[model samples]
Target: MNHYRKIGNILESAMKMVLLTGITGFLGGHLAVALLRAGYKVRGSLRTPSRRDATAQAIEAAGGNISNLEFVELDLTKDAGWNEACTGVDYLMHAASPFVTSMPKDKATLINPAVEGTQRALSTARNAGVTRVVLTSSIAAIVPGRGKAGPPHLDASDWSDPDGHVNAYVESKIRAEKRAWDILQPGTTTTELAVINPGFIVGPLLDSDPGTSGALFQRFFRGEVPMAPQLYLHSVDVRDLANMHVAALTAPAASGTRTIASFGAYSIMDMAECLKKAFPAYREKMPKFQAPDWLIRLYALVDADVRANVRELGYNPSLDEAPGRALLGRPPIPITDGYIATAQSLIERNLV
Candidate 1:
């Protein structure tokens, strides 16, 4: 058995419990399924219990038991109700956040909860005697954007200053992740923290609701993208990303470390071109034109999200995925596989 697998099995003998926030969200849904399959009981945090139907269906569809997953309604913005949620949980994967296409009224609205929520949860988890916490930091936390020459050499050592003038979501994730790592106290086992940062995550949707990344894939299949954006982002399969989270949680080796989980970056043109070649019949539908830099800039003026996305354009962000790949001990699911999987899901459901 693998080091982490052995650890998980040992944990299962006890009443081992893991708390995963945002279990209804895309990343959380993926993590919940993976963790449950590994035999550890999962306690997922939800903003409210009313939304359980959709999440339950998602777990059921993924072959996870609805009964194996438990929900605790909690709020990240407030200091109330965290103690019960964190009580007796063995590990934590803090995955909740306000990731949206629009900006928040106050940057702090997003940043404060991101920072504060982690503090609240970790504090409660510490008091409850949980030994390890794994945070779902993003590649956004690793590399926010590039300078005039392009992205700096990205490694575990690099951290994008989200509090700076980058996108609000970038800032949100940076603050949330930093708060998770800020754990420190005299004689505390819960102070042990690990973070998993993934890149532009893409894969088949666990549910019918299209994700932010899946929406981008939707555009490709709908023949609406018409052209490709000249941007490159490190892509990771959602399954690989979920596996990394489980690994970070149970692996003794991953304790007290932050790791980036991504395979590599590819251009939108490259994705469209790859789609064309992969599904030769779809070649005519794939966009042949590349959106020029100036046009992207022009669109940014009228659209804030466009402004944010345009900021990431014309730059190639390639992170060091070697650690994650080596840690997994396998080749990651190809970006092409994710594209096909997501595209096929939309096609099967008439979403496109």
Candidate 2:
């Protein structure tokens, strides 16, 4: 057998366990399904026992076998059940992190949980002798830009400036990812680390609670914003992002590497135009015009969410996906398909 297939057979024969965090969240839910389908015994962690049933149902609904999937109660902040959760697990997928568009009253509300939780996860994984950890980091961690024009392109080598005009969410992701790497330095531990830095994730939801990015479609289809804001984003389908997570687990060159999983840089206006084409019935609700920069700045004065996005207004950073694409062995799902899938899920769930 080839090297990759050899690892697969060993894992299958040994029933290698994988400890996955944030299985109740969007990306985590998909990761659970992917891992389960890959023949790995997945042990997922959640903050409460109440969410276990919902997560299991979501996995089952996604066509994942829950017989090989189990759940453990664990919190990022508290030291309750983390160590026990990592026990016997050979791989770790740290997909848990606070994601929000609104600025919290206190920045640490987001920062503490992310940083502390990453430390807790890595520290426990190291002590448990876990082989590798695939950390779900965001592109936000690599690039925090001001609204002003800057770099022409961003890649794995870049790092977000903490002092930049980024929101609490961006800051938290940067710190959490940095701490994770810090804990697993070359000589410090044998636990390997591979980080997947994906852009805005949007695709079909495996459950009712579509994440922050998925909810954008609901707003788009409801005419929540009559005009598209002057903001640019790089998006990746959740399915594609989940596949990158799985590929990172066994790729020979993935260790100690940060793979950027963004596909294309699209403006809000571009996204709305695509939505109009895909779902003509919602044409009236789709944004018909781009809100001028001055008007958006004016609204930011009174609106907290708009204020949080001000630094991103008219900001579209260049991204090169060659490295990330190489890891997937193909181009990511098209941005148009991402929008359609998210729209379909929202409609099916009666969310729109």
Candidate 3:
């Protein structure tokens, strides 16, 4: 076969292979579904082999090929086990990170794993000739929300200083993503990089394993939280976030851009009100109170999650979400869709 014909044939059979590092994560799980629907074979990794069964179930739920999905027990803190996972994968999505609310006494718990794990994943991909890599970074990496609201602007170029964050999770993500971006070697056809910076991701769980963000939204629906907070966020649905990640995998224009995706910014009362409107059943079930700033700070002292998240309540914040337009062909799922869907999901799962 001639060069062009041979290249086309190789591409056809390359399986459109992708390696998803956090297949069990909220976004990763959805991404596996998107990739499967688009005809790509996916391989995922966890810290242990035993986690494979859950990942398999997720792929199956998405109507994917359990046979097409493979899992590896890999550690982010060390280089071992990475090469095996990166082998023959066409792209890599580094979604694994230690999610937590409190600042660690030893920063290494969050920092070490996220930083080292990203290095190992990227090192392996570069060595393995992977074509593209998309990192599942949070807006937390871009906006740590430590103290000040911000200087009024930040984009792909902004960096969340490690010294400025109050929560370990934010610090870890900032440190990790910065470390990943700093990695470089002059070579073409090696692994090119992209980053997806999403705000609070919420949605229905495909299974019983509700993610951290999903579970928090559940509290709002259960009316367990009699009062909401001043907390506002420019959040996106987990499903929409997944689609953007897949788009980045092959979009040549996306190679170096950090696409900031958020459906719209809304607050605790605003979200509950949305649930009240879309899912009327939740109107009575959802919390109607909005916690005052003083009470939130008081609650933050004893509640670790509240304390770490206190920074999120400092002011009313919004996003310049229109920048992602060039990368998306259609508008993303609305932020409130996840809130309504969460209540429905809990009902469907009998978890309510």
The model with the greatest lDDT is 2
Candidate 3 wrong stretches, greater than 4 Å: 1-14, 101-103, 146-149, 185-189, 279-285
State every prediction's TM-score relative to the real structure: 0.90, 0.95, 0.88
How would the candidate models be sorted by TM-score, starting from the highest? 2, 1, 3
> Which model, 2 or 3, shows the larger lDDT?
2
TM-score of 2: 0.95
Which number leads on TM-score? Answer: 2
Off by over 4 Å in 2: 1-14
Tens-place lDDT per residue, model 1, 107-152, is 7767777788878888787777787778778888877656436654
Worst 10 residues of 2 by lDDT: 5-14
What C-alpha lDDT does candidate 3 achieve relative to the native structure?
0.76
Residue by residue across 182-275, what tens digits does model 2's lDDT show?
A: 9987667888999999998888999899789877888898898798888888889889898788878878688998999898888888999888
lDDT of each: 0.77, 0.86, 0.76
Better of 1 and 2 by lDDT: 2
Cα lDDT of model 2 overall?
Answer: 0.86
